[model samples]
Target: MDPQLPAWRIAPEDDVAVALKPLETGETCLGVALRQPIPAGHKFALNALAEGSEVRRYRAPIGIATRPIAPGEHVHGHNLRTALSGELAYRFAAVAKATPVRDKGHRFDGYVRADGGVGTRNELWILPTVGCVGRLGERLAREAERRAGEALASGAIDGVHAFNHPFGCSQLGADLDGTAAVLAALAQNPNAGGVLLLGLGCESNQIDALMARIPADRHARIRAVRAQSEHDEFEAGLRAIGDLLAAMARDRRQPVPLSALRLGVKCGGSDAMSGLTANPLIGRMADAVTQAGGSAILTEIPEMFGAEKLLLERCENEDVFDRLTAMVNGFKRYFLAHGEPVSENPSPGNIAGGITTLEEKSLGAVQKGGVATVADVIGYGERTTRGGLTILEAPGNDAVSTTALAAAGATVTLFSTGRGTPLGSPVPTVKIASNAALATAKRNWIDFDAGTVLTDGIDAASDALLARIVAIASGERTRNETNDERAIGIWKRGVTL
Candidate 1:
């Protein structure tokens, strides 16, 4: 690489190259003089282009030129428009092969659940069946934690937390079902050694109905109480949580293989370097875990528009391919149903960070899945059954998608961001920064810096990240966990009655 070239050409066929740093109008890079000043993380034309021509990034058509562009001219939303539209026919031309499982003897200390799942944390989780009782759950958790201070100090339990949300009531049909399903899955999350299900007696999301969804084997570790049935809801909740804390105290971490891991790969507050650095680094980790017989889930379905074909070809079989297709088209129809365009994405933050269109953002975002064959396609709030790369159906909202990943049974989530965010899921969310600058600037939010790929290279970064993940799985708290930045958001798609 030329030291003077402060830009990166992701692919030889790419018509634009990303500026690694600000370039003045007189400065020259890659033998091309700048037509205008280019901001860091933004793109510049590598070759002259005419109006209406295709603009390529990552060797894929990201958008179309709205007007004539000169060589080395800064390219952005002003002159570029997304070419994405309605769904098109897809064919399965398998490109990815089955990954070979290699046992490297890698292991992490985790809690072994009775259902054969492994938990990275041993905490008591208090889940509320209705939004009305969310505060009660929160109070119960605090009371339990305050009363069990000795247990917490003794390493008998990690902590007590109440995951509060606002959708259990005034919901009907799919909306109510979705709320119930997500709460049920969270209640069963392995990270929670024991669970207290607190409910308001009369609500659309009844505790009895939610309990039916949970597997029988997890019943021993879960306790349920209806507030309206109790003389004093707060006191009853506290007692229930106390019992859960006692049960959780008996849980301990044990060694488990990498195959037992379920990882969630995601990106948010992305920038130009996101695809170049952090995302791909997470992809390497995904490939490593999948190849070791573990599972990895890739969501943010709408972001997969321009690059859905690439993922389609990676489907393991016709069924999975069809499922993937349905998922994509289904989400597209959802956008249309709401009278919205399908390609309406690349949030304002993304544009300022050098991402011009959803296609460009997606081509980079999909890097989180690496090149592994997709083993399954799951709906919202569903758990992963088969190990490998699985695509989930969800929108591009960061908190919502991250929460879905956890509800779907991801023991840990690897979130790549160029612009930093303090957002986290119920599980440990490891934030990987795309550039060293963001990592340094937001030390509290960033967990790992993938920008080192430009200096130390990807292999070193991947190794370091893998080690960090193992440590996290072994109970080393991520910034989010330590800072108590945990929350959940359910995907609501129906009318509120």
Candidate 2:
């Protein structure tokens, strides 16, 4: 097979196949003549389809034909229509067993935590207990950074970041509960060595209540300060947070087993090159990480629209497969409930970059999950219990997805892009660009240039990507952090005030 050709057919039922490389008009493939130019990562019909017929990829129905599509015709959003399928109702009765592969038991230099989970980065985190105190938290973090030099140089702290949010104080019902849950999860995230909870004395969401929500065993590592009780002494809050940061800097990375590593994979601003270069390469890297006995997670429910079945077959057991199907159906319900079609996803940027349908986009998106068996499926903001490969329900929005990844206990992240973005998370995000041009153009932000996969052999490119993942896990700073693109976003399913 040509290095650019897709090595696997994700689904056995599909009559369309994705181009692993950029195939121009008239190109011969699988004994069929191309009817139109097909960009890499896009799909072409393997057989003619009458209007209303199913358009399949990854061996599942991605959409319905809007018009007659001749064999070799480009299959995309324009000629396809979103159609909800019965497979979405599929369910598994029990969870799957973990694959019986031997544990690699490798180790990376990381933060050794008392809880047993390893951290890729160690820093003091100051969280706004409520939205009202968000600014104060930010100020304290900035001050701590300035006073301590870089969090590394002063040997007191490497950095301080305020996890500010609009959802903290004024919300009620599920909204408030969700906010508190996510906040507490961030506080317990292994990436932080210590945390300072900054609260507004009068907010509806109290620091003490939030503290009670956290596990008592982890509570000792965190401290809280309220501004309203201090009689206008905001300076005291600043000093308290800053001092904790300095103390946190004294901690250092230690040798930790690879099983302790929890990694998150995400992508945004996708293009044709997205699936071809960055995503698939990251998928292979995910496999490597799992092989080393570490954890790798893939989420963003909407992006999983078309490739849900491929994931189902890979589920370790029937229960996981059921959970995976339910999650996909739930996301579709959410979209329809909002008076929108599920296919309305695959942003305009995707179309311009050669992705013509949600199915094509999804087939490529799930590549980040790699070939590993699905160990578990988790709800939004839930902690992953299984280790080999866990799938968390999340959105494709960069910040929300990264935030969910963090809440799921990922210590580091891998983000791919083709249209370019400056998004980063509280955790280190190693940005991988799909093409050489974007990598070089955004050199300061991209941690690795995956475009070489298109020019160099895919195997060689896969090796380079794996090397970068290991390096980042070992504590190398990603460009997003260095460039100060510290983006923090949460997924909101309801109103917030």
Candidate 3:
């Protein structure tokens, strides 16, 4: 980490060093002069690479060299190809657990819910059961906001939002079920102190059916309206919002243990520095949260292609291991079922940002889970009932996975990006920039500069990150919240009727 050095070898055994800055042909890294210009965040060979030999980064094979590469030569998609293939059977290897630190842990101010869950924000949410009534739900929310301006200014409730999706109607079987599951899960999120479920009675996803999906105990906090059946749908929706707000007016924040915290760790728009900086830094925060007897949810199943073993080996038990194994394979099957290769990843942006293969991207991506033992693997839109690291089943898309995280009860989500993205989830999303340049350039979108870890080190950076998370939990708005970039994306995997 010498300030004078412009390249970083992530591990002592790594065959490549990531360019810390743009370098010319004459610049030396690892005692090898660059053979070509290397962009910042790009990788360069530290030693001669033989054709068909494995190339390593993060001390693991990222891909196979397509041709012989001289030392200091740029390593990229042109010469490196992913070695990933079809999924294989996995055996469970139990990892030792860290003793819970609940005897002493961090605390945050949150709203305690009737179900014993804690809310990072006492916000009111409107969920439309069908797309037909989606705009109606928005109108209701806006009217509610207009009427509650005084209470909003007084912090009676956090800002209100209507989460509307397009596939509630004509979605059959699993697709319809998926829609209902995420919406129900959203209602269950403690962040939604009050919820208004607006529905058009004629839709396939009826208010009655969706209501049945929710727990009976949570019914009191969530009010529903059948827009088609009501004589005046708008008035009925407004009345429902008023009723929910009345109940929330008495809600307040109280000190809660970290065990009450459920964190969702995600990364998008990643670069080489993502692994070296942001992801590992978030990993520190993940381990800290789990060590304190809290919960951390990790998703983006496809990204786990080459590096899933990092999690499989850490499963708390054989059952957890088996479930995670199934989850990974199922996703691969999903890709193949659609005539797509499981190895098709590390998007164009990823390549431009120095990631050459799905394997390399995954190795970096999974770092966000830190080193915590896998406690459980939950299905998409399911809540994290376990109190350590839980893996949720979801895709690698930023929108879909972050929505799954929030639906799974993540009061706050930690999103790391190196290429930069303004996307935010239903919950408060704290964006950590992988490099200082992106952080500086997108101040409005970036929350923390994890790039500092390259200079300041991870220990301090992680502690600072956890503190920032606690503050965010205590009602401090994230960059996403301040910029109003919050939204939800339901996973639509089934056929439309």
Candidate 4:
């Protein structure tokens, strides 16, 4: 056993201690001797727990022990049961205030768009307004890439890719509005120097309607082509987009302050180690960014089921709290409408990785928020204004949640995983691994390792994570982004065309 191992007990009422590493049965740690062998990335009871005693983490009750658990013995599915449903306590003023954190005066090298928004990478985008024009957008993007390479040789543009999708048409209500909002937001994204909008003339979502909401100055960088207006002329659309891409290639990156950044932090393929290390370490990074007066967005509201109360307490006011609570309840209602209880959540992979209940998963999910005050709450595709730490309502599906975050204007994203995932998004995503073995095995995919927090001293682990986030945000090439390889997926709750 490493003598320098650090232990983290998220709650004062926690019954278990997360072992930073593998501990032998007789190893002594922090003056407390291990009563049984504990594996790295697993839990060990810190004190004897009577049957039915609550198990806590993140300072919140996660579940109850089905039987007595001796100190140092593993506390998992075999001995733990899902927490009983009850009214949650929301005591903002009652909880002790945390120590204030200061910013280190750091900033990322990014593109300062004309509108004061900062972009980590500059690219030309092509968007399809409806499924009917998906192929048109794809062709245009391919054409732009082919033509832009001559100037790309001069480093005029990073890359040109058409973001083609199939759900812009045949939608209604919030769904139709959401599709339009995502495309409009993408067009306005600072990362995009230029945008080409391809629309089928008869689609439910029209370019003119979307442009009405967006400012002309920003829309000036965009060119729109309606396939029907041009008699379904794919070649004409490609030529028009090609001309725009040439003009956009001239845009360049400029030095910017940290405050110009809006980031999205999330986790997927989660396991036990996630809550123990990478999640909290990223939480530290989230705190640093928020302290710098930058924005950090935490989404995947479904993944936040049992942990809503923790977020409510941190909300700046009642409105933000109400918005967040309503979103949580909405998800529950949505799931219940389908005749499924929200309690039977967490994918099979999550349980196999040692998370036994949704309560446990929710506790771990909130760690990505760090200790920051919940500044505000926003809905899907809503512009983020009140900055600090804001929560967005969206599902836990990797693509869907990431899509919503990117649409809300996150310039960069921190995606953590334990069982390992290959998903990526349009924004620059820095993949943080939950354990060292996965980080080493998939270095080609993962950008950083949060497992170090469990292996090395906590401070060292956190500092390492901070450094990596800083580097990635500064236009440095993360392992995934460097290859120009990405995992583009969307979480579709409605029917697909």
Q: What do the candidate models score in CA lDDT, each in turn?
A: 0.89, 0.77, 0.90, 0.76
TM agreement with the true structure for every prediction: 0.98, 0.88, 0.98, 0.90
Evaluate model 3: give its lDDT.
0.90
Model 2 segments more than 4 A misplaced: 1-47, 59-61, 85-87, 91-106, 154-156
Clash pairs detected, candidate 4: 400-491
lDDT for model 2: 0.77
RMSD of each: 1.4, 3.2, 1.4, 3.0
Enumerate residue pairs that collide in model 1: none
| Tens-place lDDT digits, model 1, residues 1-497 | 23245999988999999998888997888778998999999999989889999999988999999999998899999999999888889887755785553456689999999999998889888888888888888888778888989988887798888888888988888888888888888877888899989889988888888889999999999999999999998888877777777778888888999988999999999999999999889988888889888899999999999999889888999999999999999999999989999988988899999999999999999999987889999998788888889998888898899988888889999999999999999899999999889999999998999988887888788888999999999988899988899888888888877
| Residue 75 lDDT (model 2) | 81
lDDT score of residue 254 within candidate 4: 68
Q: For residues 1-497, what per-residue lDDT tens digits would candidate 2 score against the true structure?
A: 24555322345587877676678888888767888888766778888899998877645676789999998888887898767432355545444333444444556778777777777877778888777878888877776667667655743344677877776766777767777777788888888888888887887677887898777777767878888878754677666766566557667777776677788999999987787678988887777777777788999988888777667768887777877888888888888888878877678888877676777788889889887888889877677766778999888899988988898888888898988888898899889888787888888888888877756867788766666656777777788778866756766677656
Which 10 successive residues of model 4 have the least lDDT summed?
87-96
**Model 4 per-residue lDDT tens digits across residues 136-168:** 777777776787778666666766777767777
Ranking by lDDT: 3, 1, 2, 4
Model 1 gets an lDDT of: 0.89
Candidates 2 and 4 compared by lDDT, better number: 2
Model with the higher TM-score, candidate 2 or 4: 4
